[model samples]
Target: MKAQLIEGGSFQDSRGSISFVNDFCFKDIVRFYILENSEENKIRAWQGHKLDCKNFYCLVGSFRVSYVKIDNWDKPSKALKVESVILRASKSQILSIPAGYANAIESLEANSKLISFSTLPLDEVKDDDVRYNKDMWLLQ
Candidate 1:
């Protein structure tokens, strides 16, 4: 199991690596992940948000993830450098993101499938989740 510190902090993910928090029961909080592994296992990058902390796990494929933290709302930029990690489906690996972090994912293979878990139910919002092309940078 490989782990890294979240940007701007020294805290480390020392607990179970492939685990999800079972808090805030998810009867409908959009436990889904966007797919982009269409051609040559290429997935366009995109920005996504979660109502609560989220867990991303690949059940049957491989992919890369770049995690970012937008701390400045005024200037509004990504904190630190983009941390990239490869997630594979053959292994039970889960990436956990606390609420309020901007993150992007790309599929390394065409058959890549990612399963994301959220603390909020799926039906709690009129627009539960928004998808932006990986190229669209100036997202607030």
Candidate 2:
């Protein structure tokens, strides 16, 4: 499956605001973690899964999320096209990344926090995890 954004919205009426992604389902999510980048412009790059899916949501500040479809599991092409999107706390949305793609995240602001939802359990993550250098694919 291709990566897509699950759009969401918020409601406000003097009692503050409520943000939600109604289209995001939790049935396949077996694990989750909050990723906080201490410094701005720092990149966490080139991590992927072959059998697991991931969903990312910006909880605080802003981020640039980039991904590339893997051409080969053992050795992906360095020239693969990279796609990216900006996720901000002001906008409530979830970026769903399916299997077979490598992804990187960069914080646009200091102390940016993102929540990642995964389809695989903690025990199976190690075996399915794949990593590459931060410079594997340039993000635009």
Candidate 3:
């Protein structure tokens, strides 16, 4: 029900000379994914996992990520709280999203990219993901 930002720096990984830290203490890594946003100021919202958690690392360009707390299943759109952050390479940070929280991502630059690590595998995550209208939480 919360979002965490962890500071990271350059390190060696299978991806080569990337500004990443190969460490995860929160949860086991079930999968990794890279997402691309081809246009600037574009929004992608929203999705939430009932059991899977997520970690986000910026690989290219920049974007804004928003997390809204969904306290219970009774009202998925009723967020107990909302938090947002800007992600960019210069910041060298990673975002941790807990399960039960809905998230929205917006690209601030064209071709923005991000690497995400999840606690659940593909098939399991697909079914657990809950979707909503893009402007679902815009008014609030």
Task: Give candidate 1's error at residue 116 in angstroms.
Answer: 0.7
Which prediction has the highest lDDT against the true structure?
Answer: 2
- For each candidate, the alpha-carbon lDDT, in order, equals 0.56, 0.93, 0.78
List the candidates' TM-scores in order.
0.60, 0.96, 0.82
**TM-score of model 2 (CA atoms):** 0.96
Per-residue lDDT tens digits of candidate 3, residues 22-95?
55464588889888875554787888888888888778889788888776655664545668888896668888
**Candidate 3 C-alpha error for residue 119, in Å:** 0.6
Per residue, candidate 2 scores C-alpha lDDT tens digits across 65-122 of: 9999998989888999999999999999999999999999999988889999999999
- State how far residue 123 of model 2 sits from its true place (Å): 0.4
Ranked by lDDT, the better of candidates 1 and 3 is 3
Clashes of each: 7, 0, 0
